[model samples]
Target: MPQLTQTEMFLAVLVAIFALPYAVWRLGRTDYYAPLVVVQIVGGILLGPGVLGAALPQLHATLFTPDVIAMLNGIAMWAVMLFVFVAGLELDLKAAWRWRGETGTTAALAFTTPMALGALVAGALLLLDARGEWVGAEGQDWQFVAGVGMACAVTALPILVLFLEKLAILRQPLGQRVLRYASLDDLAIWGVLALILLDWERVGRQAAFIALFVPAVWAMRAAMVRLAERDRWYVALVWVALLGLAADWSGLHFMVGAFLAGAVLDGEWFGTERVDRFRDTVLLALMPVFFLSTGLKTQWSAGGWAVAMFALALLVASVGGKLGGVALAGRLLKWPRGEARLIGWLLQTKALILIIFANVLLDKQVITPATFTALLLCAVASTMLTIPFATPALRQLDTHRA
Candidate 1:
């Protein structure tokens, strides 16, 4: 047998990613709730340092040497950038604005409630940290606690889009309503993240980025509007790369820039089908790398039981907060009975966006690797709970209405 070269090893990873998720999706028939992406994420954790590597050190080292991991990270970063870009593009901010009163009420409640609950969880975790292993090295206390809390509040709009499609509501009025709330929350998520990540030494650079972003966005949007559809795709990738660079230089993240890059452009200009196919293709081809890389970062240093316990606590906060927040809105706005429960279940879905949020927190040293693993587990569980819980609730509402 030949020793596998770098390319060969990476190819094997690709094969595992594509094959394992599909296999699980097919065999387990988890399409309703877990979905293919969730399966892929779970598979990544299984293949990561905490699980597979711990169990089989020699094989893990052979396959995921520093060089291999670096190569994989490169792919994962780009894949996630594109994924985030598509998320920004799909954010129907115009719709959110048009329905400002209700959207604002719902978005405000949905985001802030979970955040408050998550912060309480974070505060509790901080108390149990005998060695200070749960928080970031450079991050201030408030930042770590609040960042973790915001992560709990997040909704993975991309995954939510996919989930709603599975529920046969993607194009329905209810789906659009859900999207509007999520979109507003998405903006707030990033905005608060920027504040949390502010670097005083580089404050000027960050300010300059914002100043330039305005005209840059205007120019870019104009170009996107003028270009042929064929040209827009390639140009859009270039724009993602460019804005991503600017964002990183400005003491913010490239992912934030990638989102801004797409946010500036109109979704209508790119055509819905094109946007859909591009997103699907990116997810199919590249996002597995992101998941695997994320898994590689997971560590069980906090003790598995402790991590699990904290994770369950966070999960309750996330689900309970989101549901409670939305329910508050439903009551205030006089929504039909049961609508709030159905909407709350849908809003609680979290995967890509929360993972992305947590990854940044980890990168900025706002959270420890063990804390990240706990949050990752929480995200997986929350996502898995969405469809199963929402489907019956939605049906009961429909039946009651009938």
Candidate 2:
């Protein structure tokens, strides 16, 4: 080739972003173990610095120039904000409240147990990493530990919904129960994230954002209710952008604001069918780029073996803690046997949310890229494990019922 123009290169990159993951996903029939989104994330990693960049340095360098990377990041930011906003919009908190006794107990235990175990793991890493390879430059010991802990605790609500739909149980009573539990934990996950991201220097701006957000949300709700459904969709996107900007300005991260923007707007306002289509359309058209952008950030600077080992350790904490906590909740709440295991496996599905959480931590410099890599690996493995584990559990549950 003589010389590829930037536009040509950018198109080439887009081709790679959609092509590779899809090829692997379809050819390998990875859907049983990993969904297309999961595969896209893995594709991102393979296309990223650690894998493809290592194997084909010049090609990687030539293809992912600064301008091209910037364009991808811009798209990725918008994609993720929309995804997160939809996630928040889908929170069935009212349902969670209706089943408060069970959902509350289970969600609480499921989240806190993994968090504590993950924190302990982080503390161990702090002790072991004599050169400080894991902690970020500006990170305090507590921040690093807490961030990793919270990452372990996350369950990607959107992914959970997809999994439930795949299983043909999205409308079933058990599926609704699981969604309630996940919804409660989703709220908690974001709350913990906000706490971790708190910036003392920007407290004034943060406070202002919080103070104004309430009235703004009230007015927005009023406006949304009066708008036509088509108009509401357009206004919602504007709201996402506005909140994202404000949140970024206040040091809370645009994702947080994006979520808040959606959380305040009732999903019922847009109709369930419409909301579902909106989410599915976004996933189909936008999220693959976000996954690629995410993968491009991965690094194995602390050694692949070290990161793999750490990832495995975190995986154990994430899976085991989730199961253990749910089991405890089952015993306390007197849930039917097999229910907890099924719930635990489903709740441990962490691919997108965990990746998003890790990205935020990396952005704030609270965790080094090595740590992010480890967490990313942990997230992928955890998500891949979910369906295999949950399928058998579901069968066992049905067998019990029969």
Clashes of each: 0, 0
Which portions of model 1 show Cα errors greater than 4 Å?
A: 129-131
Q: Per-residue lDDT for 88-111 in model 2, tens only?
A: 999999999888988999999999
1-402 per-residue lDDT for model 1 (tens digits): 989999899888788878988998999898877888999899999999899999999999999988889999999999999999999999999999999999999999999999999999888877876427788787888998888789889999988898888889889998899999999999899888988989898999999999999998888877887899889989999999999999999988888899888888888888999899999999899998999999999999989998898789999999999999999999999999999999999998889988888888888888889889989999999999999998998899889889
Each model's lDDT comes to 0.90, 0.92
Worst 10 residues of 1 by lDDT: 124-133
Q: How many backbone clashes does candidate 2 have?
A: 0
Worst 10 residues of 2 by lDDT: 124-133
Candidates' RMSD to native: 1.2, 0.9
